[model samples]
Target: MDKIIIIDFGGQYTHLIGRKVREKGVYSEIVPYDMKIEEIDSNVKGIILSGGPYHVSEDSPKIDPRILDLGIPILGICYGHQLIAYMSGGKVGPSKKKEYGITYVNIINNNDILKGLSKKEKVWMSHSDSVFSLPDDYEVLAYSENCPIAAFKHKYKPIYGVQWHPEVYHTENGDVIFENFISICNCNRDWKIENLLDKMIEEVRNEVKNGKAIIALSGGIDSSTAAMIAAKAIGNRLVAVFVDHGFMREGEVESIKNTFKELNLIVIEAKDRFLEKIKGVSDPELKRKLIGEEFIRVFEEIAEKVGAEYLIQGTIYPDRIESGLRHSDKIKSHHNVAGIPSKIKFKKIIEPLRDLYKDEVRKIALKLGLPKEIVYRQPFPGPGLAVRIIGEVTKEKLEIIRKADKIVREEIEKSKIREKLWQYFAVLTDTKTTGVKGDERAYGYVVAIRCVESREAMTARFANIPYKLLERISTRITNEIPQVVRVVYDITHKPPATIEWE
Candidate 1:
């Protein structure tokens, strides 16, 4: 299959670029910015330089010089655009005005990269530097109001650069830009989810080698899908352990148990044990570590009982990147990534979906015959409600947030824009507000509703939920849940605020 390799320069959208490429029916992988060209496989037909949070004037990361000499089509974005200009004997400097949001760019000339785009279109920009002057063989293709060189291309070579992010949804016709670039690379759209499932099953079988394996199934898409794939690989030798951490949403545990009954999973009802481990833990990171360590302990004990040699997890790429792996900065430590104990000596860890994004995992789940509810489940933090509660994590907070979150889900599912949203949940803020109920003063906790829409979790925008739906959710939560006095909606996007409060 034809593939595209995205060189990550610590940008938040590096993974999103790969996800977009995969969505186009082409395989793609993310590698570090300074990866050796020789390490790139022959199947890679194109290269993409991902945007980063660094300025080109500083000690920014660079691509391998050999990559330019390989005769492959290269598309640079934002920081990558400036990097390409700087490396090609061009001038790059700090912009007088930084473009951080939506901006209009006018096409100076209809080039291959912007073939199907309009004469003037809005694009998402997030950079502090601009290409002041092009190299000897490069010319401007498009120009924005603030930045003269919004898009550029080589005079003769198959190299293109864009100062805006086409992989982001804020950019109008972003997919069209990618499609034009893919056409320039002449790549074949042969990648399929079925093939990925078959390869994963075979890989699991080879890794286990006829030994028993245990999967930590949390009833989420990742864990459930991983469990199903593992079961397919080893049949009766694979055992699934579901640990109720006492932090799941309403009906989540029972729903998972009922759904996985056909797979013959072993349910471990250790809610109280998990609750006791995280008692009085107010710090979010500490709570995650405590939960992670406790999960390992529970899984280790189960491994001993089943004599399993491998412990399978549903860890995806975002978890590793957010956990400070690779060349990316640490956004937050996911429990599956940073929370795993160093003292795990009973079983070897195996993560089949480590390189996949959430959407990719969902595709695989559906392809593997999982139910629609399991496959299309909203993305949930591995730390559960511990992170949702901004301050202290207690049974009381969990219960309140669970009830409010259930109401939010129910109302959203009944709305016209339900399918348009990626994930929506209720957050129990640490503050309390005063309200009058039954002609008396009442001080109760405040709840914030977070709803975002995105193709991948790497970047998200607050969903434009209808006012009536929000009103219904807020009214239901405040009227039904006595602890919640005020219900507010969170309108911040991912860059300014994470989907989760913590």
Candidate 2:
């Protein structure tokens, strides 16, 4: 396959870069930073350097200097940009003013890589150290207000560097930059995101041949897609288990049951069982761990009776990445990844869509002929409403959040803007406030509305919802949900705040 090789330096969004490339109809593979040159076979068309949490120095995670001599097209982002400048006899150090969030870059030279971008374009930047000066053979292509060398390219070779991230959705015309890079690589745009369906089903069939496999279906896009793939692969050997963990939104359980009627679904009303383990669990990590373990226990009992030897989950790459990326990209503990026990009773664990993102998974779901409700459902956390509440778990708090969430969803859907926003939901915060209700003083909980626009969950921008819509949501939330006295909308993005409150 003609592909681009993304060198992973433990950056949070290294997987995202690969996703962007694959979305552009070109195959992409990720390798560790220390991957040997021999592994860079003839099929490799280009190379990308990913950003990470480190300064450019000799002591940092070093890349092999030999790859530069290979003459393959190379594009470095943030740290990768600085590394290229430093390696090619340029200067790199802390910038006078660090760049973060949406930034504007002025194109000094319209080179081959910056082919489609305007003279001044908005780009996504999050970095401290920058390429202070380029090498003798390199020329600066663009510059921002703070960083002198925002974009650069070698004079003779097909090498380029950009301090901003084109992989992120916040960057204006980001995909155009990748499209230009693909043209430079001269790759055949033959890959389709939906076509991966056959390969996934075949892999599942090969992995779990002649054995019954039980899947933990959460009714979300990821699990539903995985379930469909599993069913086609193993035929009647697949069993879908839905565990009600006492933390779901209003009518979510009933809706899920109705959505998956074709499959042999087993509904386990373990609300009391899960709530017991979650009670008094004020800590977020502990809540996730408890719920995760109890889920495994429930599945094990069901698997034992069904004679199922393999366990399947809808665990995607973001779930694993947020749960600490298996090594050093620590963010938070996702129940599906970090909360899994060290030992399991199943013969093997299968995740057919493990390498995919939410949007990528949606493509596969559509290809499998899944319903639109299941395919386009807003991304939900595995830990459910437990993560939505900041403090300890209780039946009262769950009811409060559930009602508020429904109101938020209802208002958004009624405005005919649900499809525009990536996720629009409510969070019941731990704080309380005093307000006047019915001409009397009343103390009630605070509910926050979070709506963001994002392609991948790695980076996000607050959705520019109409003010009238926000007012309607606020009014309904406070009036219908009597416990909520104050309703505030959250405008923070993913870098500072995750979608979930916990």
Candidate 3:
């Protein structure tokens, strides 16, 4: 398969670049910035240099010189553009005015990478350094108001660089840039979801090798899809274990049980157990750690009963990246990633979707004929509602949030924007506000509604929900849920605030 190699320079959206490539039906992989040139597969048809948080004027990691001579199409973004220019006998220096948000870039010359884009288009910019001079054989392809060299390319070779991030949603016609680059690479768009399903089944069968395996099914797309694939590989030998961690959405337990009725499933009603373990845990990371450790303990007991030698989790690339597994920085500790105890030496772990992103996983789920509800379900954190609650885990708080969240979901669905929004849910904060109910003074918990829109969860913008819908959601939550006296919409984006409150 013709694939693209993305060299990671610790950029937040490095994985997002790979996701966008895969969206074009071409496979792509992210490698460390310092990875040896020989380590890259010979079949890689193109290379993408991801933007990082480092400045090119300072001591930044150098790229392997052999990559330019490999005769493959290469594209650089933001910091990547500066690095490429600095490495190829060009000048790079700190920008007097750092471009951090949306900027307009005007095309000086239409290159293959900028093929269907307009003369001037909006692009996302996040950089402190700029390419002061072009390489000997390179010319400026585009320019912006603040930055002179917005884009550049080799005079003869198939090399390109852009001063903005085309992988993010804020950039207009971002997909056009990716499609143009893939066309330049002449890659075969043969990578399909059906092919992935067959490959995963075969790989799972070989890895299990007649050994029993248990899936930590959380009713999410990742775990559900993993369970379905594992079932196809081992049939009755695979057992799907759903542990009710007390922090799940309302009716989640029943919904999961009914969804996997055909599969060999065991429902462990350990809600009280989980709630007790996290009784006084107010710290978000500490809550995740406790839940993760407790989940393993429950799974271990069930694995022993089933005589399973392997543990399957629906851990995808985002989870691994957020958990600081790969070369990326730590955003948060996912239960499936950082939650797993080091003492879990009993069963070998299997994560089939580890390399896939959320959209990719949903494609596999749809290809496998999984239910629409499960396949198109919103992305839920593995730590469940525990992370949604800002303070200590308590029965009273959980009840309040669960009721409020249900109202938020129902109203969003009624607005016919549930599928359009990436994630829309309610959060219970520790704050208390005074209000009047039935002509009486009442102090109740404050509930926050966070809704964001994004193709991938890497970067997100607050969803522009209709004011009527927002008013409806707020009204329903405050009126129906007595404990929630106040409801506020979270307008913050992903940079300052994550999707989840915790």
Which numbered prediction scores highest in TM-score against the true structure?
Answer: 2
What's the best-to-worst order under TM-score?
2, 1, 3
> In candidate 3, which residue pairs clash?
none
**Residue-by-residue lDDT tens digits, candidate 1, 178-231:** 999899999999877557888899999999997999999988999988988898
Q: Which ten residues in a row have the lowest lDDT in candidate 2?
A: 321-330
lDDT of the structure predicted as candidate 2: 0.88
Weakest lDDT window of 10 consecutive positions for candidate 1: 52-61
Q: Considering lDDT, which of the candidate structures 1 and 3 is the better prediction for this target?
A: 3
Give the clash count for each candidate: 0, 0, 0
Error of 2 at 153 (Å): 1.4
| Winner by TM-score between candidate 2 and candidate 1 | 2
lDDT of 2 at 410: 86
TM-score of each: 0.94, 0.96, 0.94
**What is the C-alpha local distance difference test score of candidate 1?**
0.87
Q: Once superposed on the true structure, which residue ranges of model 2 sit more than 4 Å away at CA?
A: 326-328
Off by over 4 Å in 3: 57-59
The digit string of per-residue lDDT tens for model 3 on 213-263 reads 989999999999999899989999998899988889998888888888777
Ranked candidates (lDDT, high to low): 2, 3, 1
